[model samples]
Structure formats: structure tokens, C-alpha cells
Target: MGKLAQLSGPVGLLLTAALTGTVGFLPQPAAAQSLLQQEGTLAPMQDTYSFEGEADQTLTITLTSSEFDPVLSLLDPDGEEIARNDDYASVLDSTIIITLPETGSYTVVATSFSGEGGSYAVEVHPTTEYEQVFDRAVQLFNSEDYTDSVEAFTAAIALDDSQPSVYLGRANAYLGAAYLALGENFAGPQSLEPEVRDAIATDYEQAAALLKEQGKPDLAASLEEQAQIFRLVEPEPAPLRPAEPPEEPANSQS
Candidate 1:
């Protein structure tokens, strides 16, 4: 049995739903679906977001799910795994620390290597001398506070463009802002502004191209994956609930 198998029911369901891909939930015409779910639930929760951290500092991570053993990893700007653990042994209920290189944005992937069970809380970006602007942008995105994330990301990019990763990070922030407004005003998912999505895709592509030019294939691939993050959030049918009172019909002219 996988490490997550020992987890209880409520926690297992939460983690399973978080990690599993949208495609995995629906039925397929040709093949049977795998029993495993891919994503884990965050304690508060957000699918994509950012945090701040100092350069070359150990960032702490915590796990809290009933179903899975959380493996926290920090991917460097060049897209290399600076830290990981397939053998984290015990300390299952405690915190773990990992460090990042340089002062820039890094993708912190919290995955359940075992099965479907685990919830996690991570504290990376420090509020010290070296503030985490990128992380701040992500927090804004998480809270649907788009205007600030956009401004923060823009400010970050303006300060430094030497790093291709920063461009991609800010691009995502901008996209999130646009998406937030689009979601609020529009009637359905189909109403997402195509121009905005295209802008995001294009910007992300540029970031990936820059990475490729720098000869960082791994980082480039991760950037490409990020380009698809928003592409797959399928909407579920409305849930059953008590009916609301009907609105009054307009009166006919005399």
C-alpha cells in the first residue's frame, strides 16, 4: 500500500481532489480511468500562487492531510530540483525546510508521491530585508486581489529583467488579474476574454523561449506546463439546492 493509504476518509477525499487532473474525473470512451488522483489540497487552498523568500535561504514547509505524505520541492530558476525527498522517513506531522538559489521566483511543487492523502501549509517567502515581490504577487492572485498583484509583478519586472523566470511570473499575474475581472462580469466560463488568454499564452511563450535560449531545458519545460495551468479548469454542473423565489414578470403595455 502507498503511504497515503493509511489516511482517513475526509482527508483522503480532499487531497485526491486537489492533485487529480480535471480529465481524470470524467469518464472516458475508450479506456478505464486510473484510481489515483494527482493533486493534494492546501490547508487554506489555492491551485496556483506565489510567495516571497530570501536568496539562498532555507524555506520551511508543513503538511496536514489525513491521506498522503507530502513531498515539497523547490525548482530553481534554471528549473533544477534544489531539494526533494522520497525518503523523508517520519516527522510526518512536523515541518520541513528547503532553500532556493539567487533572488528570483521559483516553482514550489507540493505533490503527494505516494497515493491520495495529504494536506499542506508552506511558509517560504520571508518578510525580512529581502522582500519576496513575486510571492506577494501570487498572494494577490490567490485572494482575487488582481490589481495589486499586477502592480507588484510589474514593479518586479521593471526592477530586473535579467531573469527570464520573472517575466513569466509577472505574465501569470497579469493573466490572473484579467481572468478575475472576466470571471466576475461574464455569465459563463466560455465568456473568458480570448484576447486576454492569448496575451497570457504569448507572454508565457516568450518566457519559455528565453529559457531555451539560456539552454535551460528543464526550466523551459516547467514554464510550458504553467502556460497550460488555466487551460484545464473545467466547470462542473450546478449543485442541487433549495429553489429561490421566482422574479416578477414585466407588465405588458396597455
Candidate 2:
């Protein structure tokens, strides 16, 4: 399977629909508008729409349906999968927040995860600065570029400090960086600098507080526990190198 098929939940269905000439295309909409809304039926097939997008433009695309579980994917002008979402949060709906890398006509794909037919609504809108930064940070995190991810998440926090998820993201980035610094197999947290270690704990604490304020006590408690454990963990000792073999003893006989 191609990368698009792997990342996009139902691209196989999309391909089948395409091969059978069953795929449907929605009306092309102007991308300059602040908001674009489309209502369509999946009918056990995928629906595609095209709109112009600009470089560095951040957009939040949401797919919602009461009839079936929705999956959404965005493709660049080159038909590369830019972003795909099977679910947002813990719900069946889907949302993709992405920053366009270049200007071109982008395609939006809407389909059902389970091959069930249903009416769905797709919305495209430019995201706020904070969301764009947060989305980039998340992309960085997923790519394992923890250092840049940390910076991006920090920028996001500066823009909107009230979001628990931002704090959580930064904490994860910090932890990832710590692991990278100490070597992936280094156990515990001993080798980590005090400042970096403390930063990780602090971000988790902050996230927990924010989640508590949001009335999500269970999630808040989990973060709190993680912070406590992280603070107490110790790094494992580095492996000892094997001693060099004794130098040849015998030249003396001569």
C-alpha cells in the first residue's frame, strides 16, 4: 500500500471508488473566503473538493456526521497526504489542523471509516495563530524533532497559556528531548540536567492544574502522578566497557 493509503484510514476504499468510477466531486469553492461549508452524502464512497491554499496558511478542517463515523484527509497540490484524521479528541468526528507548506490547489477528502453511507458536513476555516503554532508543534513532535517541537510548543503556550493541551505537549517534548540527550537506552533520569528535568515536571504540573480547572479531574490526577514519578526516577549507570586483553607477555624469550 502507498503512504497515502497507510495514513488515510479508508484510502483503499477511495481507490476502489476511483477505479470503479464511483467517486464523486463536490463543487470547487473559492479558498479566499473565511469559511467554506459543504454538505454531502458519503454513500459508501468518498467525496472530494478542491480549493486554493497558500503557503504558511493554517486551516482547521472538520468533518462531522451523525449517521456514521467520518474520516478526513487533506492532500497537497501534488496529491501528497498533508494531513489525515480519523477522530478528534475522544469522539467519532474528525478534525485536521494543518499549515500549508506551499501555495496550490488542495483537495479535501471525506469518507466513512466503516464503509457506511451517511450525510456529512465539512468545514474549512483558517485557524488562529495559537492553533497554527500548536498544530506545527504537534507535527514536530510526531516527527521526533523534540527540540524544535519544544520551541514551537513554548510559542504556543506564550500565545495562549490557558490551554492544558499546550502544556501537555510541551511536557512531552521536554521528555522526548531528555531521552534524546541521555541516549535512548539510558534508564531512569539521572543524566538529565536539573533544569531540563525540572522543566518537564513543571509543565506537567501546570497542565494538571489547567485540566483540573477544566473539571477533568481524572486527567489532571494522571498528570500529577506522572509528574511525581518523573521527579523521583533515577538514571541507570552507564554500562562499563570490557577491560582490554592483557598485552602479549612473551617477547622476552628472545
**Top of the candidates by lDDT:** 2
Each model's lDDT: 0.46, 0.69
Off by over 4 Å in 1: 1-131, 184-198, 217-254
Report the lDDT tens digits of candidate 2 across residue range 128-180: 67667777887798789999999998998788787766777787788778888
Q: Assess every candidate by TM-score.
A: 0.36, 0.57
Give the lDDT of residue 29 in candidate 2: 19
Clashes of each: 14, 2
Task: Give a tens-digit lDDT track for model 1, residues 87-174.
Answer: 2212232223455567765555555655444455433322221124544654575576867876775665565444454455456566
Q: Please give the distance, in angstroms, between residue 212's alpha carbon in candidate 1 and its true position after superposition.
A: 0.3
Error of 1 at 4 (Å): 31
Give residue 81's lDDT in candidate 2 (0 to 100).
Answer: 91
Whole-model alpha-carbon lDDT for candidate 2: 0.69
